[model samples]
Target: MSHPTAPPPYEDHNPLYPGPPRPGGYGQPSVLPGGYPAYPTYPQPGYGHPAGYPQPVPPVHPMPMNYGHDYSEEERAGSDSFGEWDNRKVRHTFIQKVYCIISVQLLITVAIIAIFTFVEPVSEYVRNNVAVYYVSYAVFLATYLILACCQGPRRRFPWNIILLTVFTLALGFMTGTISSMYETKAVIIAMIITAVVAIAVTIFCFQTKVDFTSCTGLFCVLGIVLMVTGIVTSIVLLFRYIYWLHMVYAALGAICFTLFLAYDTQVVLGNRKHTISPEDYITGALQIYTDIVYIFTFVLQLVGNRD
Candidate 1:
């Protein structure tokens, strides 16, 4: 034992090699200020020790240390800026379209309505009372059908919105004027109430936190039913005495259309995808405007009919 010397320790130097397994998770129980671990130490991958020998400090590279993944503040800021720009562009384009669609449609519609409504008083006396009204109605119905069904390659929605609005105003004015002979203040008041309700529903969709995406399908089904009911009722009016029934159908139409308005607005705001096309912002606005106008008119009928 007096002349015996131990053999030199073995050394292996490959970075990727998984060294001897640790008894516990590594990098835990952080070293104390003096470099001693608070608890028993776990060995790093290259920290080999023979029996009864103390651990040695391993080699560190000249390159920067990589603790798996590290994020720099500069890199994080650049990524955030790019993301914000893209989102802002999308939102800005969307809002521009919204105003363009709504404004064009409303202007055209109001112009047409003023031309006719202001020219004709509701109390004007006319011969062949029923025939003239039917002809006037046919003109409006034809216009509405073209606006609803005509979807072509050209950006016709703006033109259509203009046309539809013009016709809508005409219809409203004529209806309002003629109904004035029978129009108690009640009907106009009813219309104002309906407008308030419709606007309230729209505001609630945007403002209130309750999610309304699920109601889209329900609104579409009810909208179709309301349109069909209006058509069927109009047809049946020729065969029977049901003017009061028309008012009832009108009320239902108002309710259904209000729901459609809520659903459609949500789509424009990206909350729903109820309609297939979104690029034609005007078309969507017109659909909403048409529904609201119809609801207002129908609501007016209740006021007009009330004794």
Candidate 2:
């Protein structure tokens, strides 16, 4: 058995770590009775420090600011507006082509009329061959109606152009023959009035919000009635002439064709629910031209009767 050695005296300090005496051994608070690792220590008022020490402050960091942002809503709105603008541009282009075609048809008709009216030989020849003229006019009218119904806007370009041109020339020649019967002064006055009426109606149709396309069914019924009325009036005028009845017929015809013009113009503009296809520019022009032709014919009749 080994006996325990006696501790050194208080005056004999440790040679390896020589220091002043501490209130606590090792100058730290111990967690266990025998010193191992020490527990965390804090400053105490009655200990080496009279007052507690201040705690260290943590550094503050600012929140990140996002300078650039996504503008998805604005971009979407701009895209929608651009799409609407493109639609309007396309609609306007279709309308322009229709009008251009109608203008060409009108010019051709006017040129034929001028030639027949001003040139004496053509007018005399047509007047002398009245029977042959009627037969030819009937054939032309039949051919025009057949081609319009059959071909329409379905055929390819050059064929469509050729058929429409032939039909227009035939119709114009007939119109020229009719105009040759009227006095030059009467024809001029009627043409001026027809042009003024056409301009006014076109402007009105363009600006008005009223939907004429919806009234197509009603117009068709009215057309049949007008045709019957015209036939009766023609038979009456042939057997027994009534000046007032002729005037009424002319006035009614003019009104009908004017409404037709407004309706066709709306269809061409594509502002209606039931609209002509954008590709059917030729059909649109043909409808408008027919309306104008009827209007002119009625106006001429009214003026010719007055004379």
Candidate 3:
């Protein structure tokens, strides 16, 4: 090889590209490294060039803003959201249909209970107090409240649903047959009240969309208070103390209970953390069902007393 070339003379030094920060006024024109393919340089139209050149315009549209990292990524996210929405809609729809079927089932159960009471040629007193029928109702309501609202005693929802169904069916059947102090007209009035409360509470749930999860603890405390108050009032009434005050307490209790039902139902329907199973649907139906039935029965008793 030839001897190594000496450092270039002062005027001959050709530094390769002068490194990045150019010395002249051309401070690297904010371009991407290769200048975006040079944007097609235009030639001057003098010297017999196409002077009247009708230059076709470059297309001005930008490449789409990539919301996704890849095509499959966008597609996957879109399909997931759509699928979740669709699944929820279908679940609610099927639940509603199932609710209707269960309602019919309850009515059939009531008819059976009623037939047993009347066709059995049983005494009226025996038919009336027949082995703590109302206690089953209390258990059903408590079961629903627990299942619909709480996360503690998990997986009991399905058993609770079956129990409530059996209880209501039994109640309906018995109530249909036996003679009672309250008339059907009174019951009808109660039904209307219950229905109104349900609708109002549901509308409130939808319109507000407020998170009331904190109120859950307060509700439990209040339920205990109501139970204790009812027991005390029952004892007092047994001693021949006519306390209309207890009725007022009960009326307010009913109102609170109605709101609770609505809020709880909304949570099951929309609360993301509360994954509603098929049993939850049954539980929800049971909640509304009891709310309606009791409010109806209560109002019926009060109305029928107008003699």
Candidate 4:
């Protein structure tokens, strides 16, 4: 030991061999046993971070424990029942509104028909001045087109009411004029038959499972057939009135309009393939009214003893 410790026992240092442990443990540089160059050491990392490094923290905020309460069975049932009731109420209201409008229109038409039928002076004047009938017919057609085809005018507030009133008046005048040519007894009978048929058809449509609203193609075909038949009948009548042919045409018209009444009623009811919206109450009333009036006209033509 006093002789330079025998020069540390003369070891051969190799570059690939591991060095001796140092006094500073794993993180310090250490020399080999043969005095080789010191190699650097680093601390090993833990599971999620470096052994000596600080861990990052995430920001926190309060969260609602229960966002919404679970509805009980009774509460859910109550909600469903309420929804059904509300829907039924709305539908009932719409139907009532449509019927009220129809009632007023019919009343106006009935008054006009009475005036033209009973008032001899007015009837004579209407017959003498055919121009008045033509004018009223023109007005009826114009207003009918606007209401039927133009949604904007039909749905607009005051304008819709105004146009509908004018349309009804013109139609009433035209109807009254035609009625004036028929005997009062025939008109009254026709009115009775029309009212009975309308009531029966409406009741049937409301209760029946048959969906007449899906018969659009059938309706169109019927209309075309009716129109063609009427044109042929008119030509025949011009040559010479055949009583049977006229009767047949009138019967066909009445039947077709009766079907139309059923279809329109189903549409208004909305439990069908096709339906009119609740907002289109005016349109619905118009359809039903037209069907009834046309039914009356055809019935009158079929049964009336012309004056």
The CA-based lDDT of model 4 is what?
A: 0.84
- Sorted by lDDT (best first), the order is 4, 2, 1, 3
lDDT per residue (tens digit) for residues 1-307 in model 3? 4532332233432243243432211222323344332132233333234462344355444556666555576667765434343476766774575468556754664455444434444435444575544664566456556655665432464665465566565455444433243444554465567667767876776677565544677777767887787787778887885647556655756765765666565555554333345445555565556555554444444445421
On a 0 to 1 TM-score scale, where does candidate 2 land against the true structure? 0.68
Flag clash pairs in model 3.
110-172, 110-173, 113-173, 113-174, 114-173, 114-174, 186-300, 190-296, 191-296
Best-performing candidate as measured by lDDT:
4
Runs of candidate 4 exceeding 4 Å displacement? 1-86
Better of 1 and 4 by lDDT: 4
- The TM-score of candidate 4 is 0.73
Task: State the lDDT of candidate 2 residue by residue for 1-307, as single tens digits.
Answer: 5522333344554443355534322233323334343443334344435564443243233444545755477666764434333488788888888889889999999998898788889878877777745764786676567655765433567777876787788778888888888877777888898899889989988899999989889889879978998999999999999999999999999999999898888877765655766767778887888888888889999987331
lDDT of 1 by residue, 1-307 (tens): 2522432222331233335433322433334444543444444333334333354454343456766656688766754434333355664576567656565654554454444334344234322254555666776777666665767522464575567655565555445444444434655476568668767977787786655566756766886888788889988987996877877887787677677667666665553323324455555665666666666666666566532
Candidate 3 weakest lDDT stretch, 10 residues: 22-31
Residue 50's lDDT in candidate 1 = 36
lDDT of 2: 0.74
